[model samples]
Target chain A: MHIPNGFLDAKTIAVTSAASAGILTVSLKKTKAYLEDKQIPLISVVAAFVFAAQMLNFPIAAGTSGHFLGAVFAAILLGPWEAFLVMTLVLSIQCFVFQDGGLTALGANIFNMGVVGVFAGFLIYFFLRRLKIKLSISAFIASWASVVMAAGITALELAISGTTPLIQSLTAMVSFHCLIGLGEGFITVAALSVIFMARPDLLKEKAFSKKITGLVAGLLITAFFAALVLSPFASSLPDGLEKVAHNLGFISKEAPSNFSVISDYQFPWVKNKSLATSIAAGVGVLAVLAVGSGFFLVLRGREDGA
Target chain B: MGHSYFDRYRQVDSFFHRLDPRAKLLWMFFFILVVVLTPAQAYTAFLLYLLAVFVLIRLAKIPLKVVFKQSLIIVAMVLMVAFFSIFKGSLEQKLLLIFNVTAKAWLCLLASILLTASTPFELLLKGAQSLRVPQVLITLLSFTYRFLFLISEEVSRMQKARKLRDFGNSRLKHLKTIGHIAGNLFVRSYERGERVYQAMLLRAFKGEINTYSDLRFMQTDVGFILITTGIMLPIFIFSILFTTQY
Candidate 1:
């Protein structure tokens, strides 16, 4: 979703960057008062959790693995404003330290994943909540809608930039995301159920049905444990992007880089795809927990003291 | 909690870091413009652009390894896209065009990374608001930056709990459990938002956000913008004058 500089025309990137910067600035001022002592640590830890969850990718079809974006989850826990801040921070670290995203496209990436994903997802949840939708059902619908909307926004941006044809890009992004959304929707619902069981105190306005929680917990617990044990055996399927790229006659468009540190994750002993992914996941979870958690505590403590 | 990294170095004593964010924004804008406007066939120009970014990377004292590493995501995307372009034309021509795209993108990435790394997120937002960016957008972005990590941490605890109890399952069942975990996360977040909003209302019950931070343009800011623009103007002119048909 992060549109690197060269991928977009000069005019497009310029206008988009300006637009994103403007929106983000206004967002900061509007929410300044809400950023209090308690909220700071809470938001940071949640962001770290999302960062960790993103590492555990489930294989789709052929060999490609698609990880959770957690956009809707962020918006759901934190407001859209807080979600955006957290995402920007996460992406900043990812780009500067880990090289996960391109620097030039940070604004665009924020626009797509951060802005569109967080706000749009929350909006859906808001509408659904207002309609007297049940918390569990609303979670499902909100999470699904957010993922789909984000994917749509991403595809639209790509089309506008002439990266791919309009319909083709939209179809590719949306279709694959739809499948991915199913996974997202279910995950969101299950997580909410757990919270309902453990911290029912958090559900002040939204009523939690214990019966549903038990049912969901029983089902999801069984499923999650199964995944942890069988994670390495998940199918290696081509994800939404790869499938679309292949079908759109752009399969051969890829070129090799002159230099890349972690290109393809090809190592000496980690020849197995699932093993490599697992290793990556292990490193990611540890990093997010150790570094992310430690960083949050330190920063929050300083801000509170100041 | 990790709010300071974006602006950590902005407070550091450096000529580039102290420049007004608006001025820095313009500098980054033009740098990207020059890079993007270059034709995909302009191989030399692309190489030159990379060299220029590399020079800035050195001058700014940013870690090269970090910048390059952060760029892997874009690199992967570029490669993925380029893979599709392999059949577009001759293998050699396709490679050159892809390289052109990749190199230009890399330079632009470095430019923005340096900007954010050097500036504080707060000041960056302040700069944007001062520039008349919409209040809603800025507010939303600020919250996003401010609370993302906290939300992530919450989700982590929930996952940890799930892991502790679900110690035994098959592959298919494991995926189902993972799926359920995601679902639960969504529900928990939705409920959390309600509490957070209530907490906010209790604090003010106001529709508008108020902030206290002073931002002013300094001579160094002007010098910084001028220097960046002046250095890159020739490259833009040359690319325009010697435009070649791809």
Candidate 2:
């Protein structure tokens, strides 16, 4: 989401702008190491392509449509650092020329959509590939997760800025984005499948050095624990999981009052809560794959018939 | 493309247009910073800020309707945030939040719109470059600017073709067709990118882009900056005093 100028207070703007500036500086340096003479034009073209692609709307449901955000798409095609640069450029132009986003809030917008979206999406895809997931499936999951994660961060920023309460903003943002993520997942899968069919050569993967991979993994682990530690400040009220459990009448009357790990793993859908959670996750994965491939097959079949 | 879209009034003969792009950019930054940093309770100061912007809009001779339409997006966004504020505070606080957010966002947006409307995009980029922004960023902005219109034209053409094909009514089928169009656009852009690079190389292209500077700071620019600052500083002080008194 593109936060406007007045939506954030001075402290939030300063902190986010500084952080964005730092990250973009680092990205510019990283991009320079690999950006050859020929690749420069490619980067520009890819930036324009992402901008153009964003202008193309596809139907998501009856009387509703969504355009591509292109962060994950760009990261998958170009490298993450270059993708970051491209996103920043696109956002700047949208702000300066089109007045689509605010100038003062550009840093926050860039941080949320460009940096967080690209890195999280790329990391998810990287891990999924390591786990031997198919390319299209990984792309779908990555794109979905990226959008949801960006929304989460946006909610957090709004809450921290005191524009809204943490729990309310988080719940509203997350619930709405769950559906948007589905659209994102489907589009990413469909687009990637087409590229795979049409020009597989363009799908070259960059190999990160072992040291860099280790460093990234370490950073991610630290960030995860940091989030866990800070999560207490997110809301005094029950979290989404707990709220869902309570609403669905999953809490047992005879359950122990102590914070037990087993109780934490409870779900509402079935008697064996932990097993049900696992099964539900599996089923969700299967559903996404089925829908993604079904779309892919229909398109390929149409192409062949034509 | 219509001429009224980007840099619509750049060719107009006005005081704002004649000033150095660098000065206009500095003024924009200053105006935005002041508008954002002003206390939310400073209603008088905000009025003064709006009046100042109104004066600039008049001096620039751009149509009020154009500025208003350009500014409607920011107003809409502020209204959305204001609606969300209803879930948070008491009635008075909610009203205050709405007023503050709307005023600040509107003022900042108007300042930015004035900058773009008065200066050419190329001049803005040149001004940014002269300010020591990174070369890579400038390059990216220039290329994006150069091709954004062209790529958008290509996208519309593709949409027209898709319409002509009588695509199926099914939503799933429509999504697939859109995906195919995106794929084709990407492929075409990639090829075009390579050709453009080759063309540049043939013209003795180096890894760097060089441009000549013709920017000159005149006495009028200094007078404009001084007068604006003189008007804003007193209102800023008064607003701070007025805010603290309550």
Candidate 3:
């Protein structure tokens, strides 16, 4: 999802960069009035929590693992503006420290994942909540809707960058996200439900009624079965962005990334691409969780002990 | 406990690190322009761009391994994109096109990495602000960066608690457990946000945000800008003049 620097044209990068900067600045400024010195510790703690959660990609199908988008989680938790800021920081650290995203393309990434993903998801969640759906069902719908929309917007960004045609990109993004949305919906509902069970007061919304626990439980059971059944087909099709790239000329135009140690995970030692990708994905999850959890515990311990 | 990543090297004194972020930003913009404008088929020009990036990376003292690792993520994506092209396109055309993309992408990544490596992210934010970037955007980014990791940690704890209780049971059970963990984390974060907002309200926040940001356009910033332009301008001119198709 992190569009690296050279994959896009200069005009694309410049315009997006400028626009992203504008949006990011507004987000930052809007957060200031809400900032209190005491909240810093809590904010930092949750940010790390989001980061770690993203790392633990649950196996969605037989061969594929999907990570959390955190947009809904961030927005619902932090408010729309604040969520954008937290996500941007995650992306920056991911790029600079961990080398996860592109530096030159940071603006585009933040725009896609941070700004578009967070805000779109938040707004959708907001509207869905207003529609008077069951709280759990509303969360499920809102969370699913947000990620799907974000994915569509990302495809649009790719098209605007001239990497692929709009329809192809849109089709590809939307199709894959259809699957991702399931996982997203389940995660959102599950997380919210447990919190509803454990500390109902923390929901902060007056509308968070307890009557919907049965509905939430029913949804979770259904999603769990759906996930279990769908696991085999997760990687059956090419993702939306990739499909669009192929249909457009960008796939042909792409150079072999200079850093490929193993081409297509087809190394002689690891003959199976599936095995190789899964291993790498698993490693990434563990790495992110370990680093994030360890770091936060240390930080929190220090603050509490002080 | 080590939370800072974007600004890790900011406080470190260096010739390159002290340049104004806006100046550094301009340099990055121009550098990316030259790299991207060069047609993917322009192998010689691509080589030149790569060489230029190599020199800059060396000068900046960014670890080769680190840059390479970062580049690898993009390379993986590019490879995935070009995977079919390898089999489908004309051999030379595919090669040239792939080379153009991979080379240009790598070079551009290098340029941006250098910018971040040399400047603190907070200062980078301030630079954007001074450049008249919208306050809304900055506010969004500020909160994103600020809380990204915190939420990540909370999710981890919930997962740990789930795992400890479940102890690597059936796959279905594990999936359900994971889902529950995610739900709890979301609820916790949502509540924390309400508290944070209340805290903010107590601070008397207006719609607009003000920061104690200080930006100085020093001689070093000017020098850095001049040197970058001196190196990049010719390449940009040449790439435009002798445009090659890949």
Highest lDDT, which number?
A: 2
Q: Quick one: ranking by DockQ, best first? A: 2, 3, 1
Q: Which structure is stronger by TM-score: 1 or 3? A: 3
| Sliding window of 10 residues with minimal summed lDDT for model 1 chain A | A253-262
- Using TM-score as the measure, what is the rank order of every candidate, best first? 2, 3, 1
Stretches of candidate 2 off by over 4 Å are: A59-64, A209-233, A238-306, B1-4, B166-168, B244-246
lDDT of 1 at B125: 77
Cα lDDT of model 1 by residue, B212-245, tens digit: 8577888887877777677677766676557544
lDDT of 3 at B159: 66
Name the better of 2 and 3 by DockQ.
2
Q: Report the CA-based lDDT of candidate 3 relative to the real structure.
A: 0.60
TM-scores of the candidates, chain A only? 0.63, 0.71, 0.64
Model 3, span B1-246: residue lDDT tens: 235654565565666676788887777767876676666655666777778778877766677676676556676667644753443334565565466567877787777777777676677788888988666545545665666667666656666676678875865566557777766665566567658766776887543468886788998888888877887777666765575332
Q: Fraction of reference contacts reproduced per prediction?
A: 0.26, 0.45, 0.37
| Candidate 2 lDDT, A101-212, residue by residue in tens | 7778898888788867887777778778879999888988888877887787777666555565456677777777777777777767777777787778878875432337
Off by over 4 Å in 3: A10-52, A75-100, A103-111, A114-132, A156-173, A198-306, B1-13, B84-89, B132-172, B186-215
lDDT of 2 by residue, B123-154 (tens): 99998899899887887788778878888889
What's each prediction's TM-score? 0.61, 0.83, 0.66
Each candidate's DockQ:
0.13, 0.25, 0.18
Model 1: how far is A174 from its true place, Å?
5.8
